[model samples]
Target: MEQFPILLGAGIVLLFVFWFGFLSLKMKMPNVILYILLGIILAKWISHHEILHFASEIGIVILFFLLGLEFKLKRLGGIARKIWPAGLLDVFLNLGVVTFIGIWYGLDPFYAFLLGGVAYATSSSITAKLLGDTGRMANRESEFILGILIFEDLVAPIVVAIIIGLSTGEPMTLFDSGILVIKIFGITVAAIILGKTVFKKFDQFLNKIHDEDFKIALFIGIALSYGGLALWLGLSEVLGAFLAGMMLSDVERIERVEQTVHPIQNLVLPIFFVYFGTTIQFVNGVPMLPLLAILVFWSIAGKMLVGIIGGKLYGLSPRVSFRAGLSLCSRGEFSVIIASIATGVFKIFSGIYIVLLALIGMLLFTRAPQMTNKLFGKPVKKKKGLKVPGS
Candidate 1:
């Protein structure tokens, strides 16, 4: 009851956040930048930590769950296996190189690992949006782009899980690593099996419910519950939310689930961005500018270079390859998620890096098509009615 004022203030913050996003969209600016900007402004407001933490946590869970709904089990396996080489290269360039750079800067090994994970994944939401805006979805290089984005979505959870496990105050041992692996494997396999057998019937039951609102509520409950259960099982709840999405992917029409849930996701995900922004107090002791510059470079160059290599392996031209690589430059949700969960230097570094990366990625996305056309006339083939869902 005493927290009522804080809740009111938070609602006001969300209104401004929504307006800022709307304005940014009109200007073709990434909303993440606006969220971060608003968050920084809110920093001076002095809000309670718990409410923000809870909203932001649920926001992230819903985000990953929605992200999972985008890919089906069958399509993902086919894509990942075909693009393994490029996916492997993306890991090396973005993650591995950035980690080595972190080490070279004299940070601890653990921080370096965090930095690598921070650099490794591209922002699926932004990339997909940009492609739609630019009319490049069916472009020759887009298949590769989609493939890599899917790959990142897959890799991010495992990396976050490991980082969380090792970064805790307690020292990690071989026994702990074994326990982590078993937990991940056991839960994931069990979820899949149950989803197909037990949950299939349950999903059919959900589909039979005539009340749309109730069905939507039930789906949201299932997603969040699995995430909570995963947390209790000593694994990353993000992974659980993702697995939950995958489990229901086949049984339900993703289109309906997404339509029902996207509004909820919209309301919450930005809170994470804002909550993260408020925590960014770069003060006297932090090496703010230097790390920002390096990570900005690391985030862009690594993705671009790896993207080029991936494009080449996929038999694209040098022009197409460069465009493909450049297209992957933006780092969004996962990078921010990594920062939010961490503390001290790691947190600060990730926040600065992602903001810079997002800005740079946005700038590059504008130029990828035009630049590719300049390099080779008509980089994209004639549009032949390719439909990317949720694009």
Candidate 2:
């Protein structure tokens, strides 16, 4: 019976998340920022629920799995061509700058590297949500934004694996890192090949399911199963889920899978942000504010700089380039995931830093066309649009 309160409390928090999300829709703010704030406000109350923690992990795996469903090798190849320069830009300017800033702030070199990573990847969840919400997915700049995001998503597993390994044991040598890379590549190749063979078989079975609900259940189970298998084999479960998603991307009537999974994502994704917010210990949070400010600035400006350079490479105008940078402003899921693995002040800094960046990213996304229009010529307005955001 005592556990009932935990469930009740969770339901209440989710209710607030839903309410705030509705309000944010009108205001054009990200729902994720609101969820985090709610979590922070109720942190003491929410901290004890083990169920929510597990749910949040499920949320992460499912979210990434769905993100993977959106692409195949061919689409990914196309995106790779468009994004590698900006992705490299994200690596050099956006990523490296923050690590330097972290060291300059007197953090240990290792901790600074972690901070760099924390700042490096923008939140695909938030950005993709925003793009979908505002109907900007078809925009030229959005393509660049998504390209950078997908590229980051692909790289994140490697970074997370390295950090997790280091935090648990002795430092890795260059040779060890090389071996890890090869291992991951091997897993990826295996997943792709396996997906091709398995999903083809699954599709044949899928056609036999006449009931809609059953089909949805089957698809979710398959994704989770593949994802779990991936984890068991020494890869990130999220990566495995992604591979599972991509495996069936080319399957007949896959849009049904996409639709089925979205509602699940919509429900679970907020739990992740809220749980992440609860993890932030605000007692010593003030001292990290200065560092947070610097990270937030780089998260926006660095991306903008990269966008300008990248946009030019694509023969886009300064306005479009600037918008692309703006699009990259937000960081969400990965940032929180990184912080969760760390202890002490670094974790606190990362948690708050992501919130700050998310808000900034939402602001930039909402105002993108307006900002561009102020200096450059007016953008062709897309009628009847939602947006890409965690909002």
Candidate 3:
């Protein structure tokens, strides 16, 4: 294949993405799925490109940062409280139950646990975008969905770190684990303190800036910087981007800020999904077909159970809980991240599983409201015609 200049390649990719986006609108499909398909089709050329990877990261970070702007410190705390029970249930069902199943199927314990990690985590990127696209961001179950995603984000890195340690024959010590915990705590506290103090005065400073270009640069810079800080601390950049947004929650000109951020996010976010698609290779073909089937079934079941049971614990009504359950079944980036560590058949298995669940999850998400309404929505009474007496 002839190599195009980086600039030309990027332009072509973006144009393809635009075409996909147009089709998504016409078909009423989620762009996430479409972008991934585009990636798979172009995988040979674009696979493992560093520029693509960095651009994708920027897309996701901005998406989460926008999400954080909607949630302030107090609201975030309240959400954490309501979500902890569901969060625990999510871990038990998705991680614990899936791992147990993997072990029962006679896989090595370490690999089984790795499989469990793959099954865990609802794709925050996909879920967040769906919530916004479907206009469910303010819906009752959105809180539950976002809370569960956040909980998984916090837990998954530790799982990955442990797995990496074991994979390298040097398991993390208690000291290492403790240090990791402290880093997480430290970042959280820092975000909260900054939000309460520095960003409280940030709005006025923004008002003083006359140059729109400078303002846009500064706003995006803060988000990227904080997200980078999270990565530096060996944590997920999504968490950092979110906290960065929370930090700026104190600003009064949130509307203006969002206007500045949304176009950039929209422009780049599709590349992330496409890049995700480019990573999946089917070298060994599908392996352990039966085991894969069982895991897929349980992966869906586990997340549904978490949504139903955990949503109740989180105080959602039965119907809404069901909706939440259906919505939470998709796995994305985190699953891919964990799965990328596997070799041979395991990698193929993880790729197939991720693609399947992501497609299924998005479909379920789109249909949840209709399904819930059918199941639990109040029945409509048919009125008798006044002319029936004449009949």
Q: Name the candidate that leads on lDDT.
A: 3
Candidate 2, which segments miss by more than 4 Å at Cα?
A: 1-4, 26-28, 165-169, 201-204, 288-290, 314-317, 380-391
Question: Could you tell me which 10 consecutive residues in candidate 2 have the lowest summed lDDT?
Answer: 280-289
Tens-digit lDDT string for candidate 1 (1-391): 4644777777788789879989988987667667767877878774445677688778877876776666677765676677989998988888888889888988888888888888888877667656755788778887788788767765776687777777785656778677767877787787778667877766567667788889768878878898898889866667788778877777655687777887787788788777767766655554556866787876788888877878888777898889888789988777866777778766776766776677688778878778877777873458788989998
Q: Residue by residue across 1-391, what tens digits does model 3's lDDT show?
A: 8867777778889999999999999999888889988988888888887788889999999999988898888988999988998888888888898889888999888899999899988999999999998999889999889989989989998888888877887878999999889988999999999998888888889888888888779888999999999999999999999999999886896988898888899888999999999997766457889998888888888998998999999998898899999999888999999998898888888999998899999999999999888888863678875575557
State how far residue 210 of model 2 sits from its true place (Å).
Answer: 0.6
RMSD of each: 5.7, 6.2, 4.0
lDDT against the true structure, per candidate, is: 0.76, 0.76, 0.89
What lDDT is reached at residue 99 by model 3?
88
**What TM-score does model 2 achieve against the real structure?**
0.87
RMSD of 3: 4.0
Worst 10 residues of 3 by lDDT: 379-388
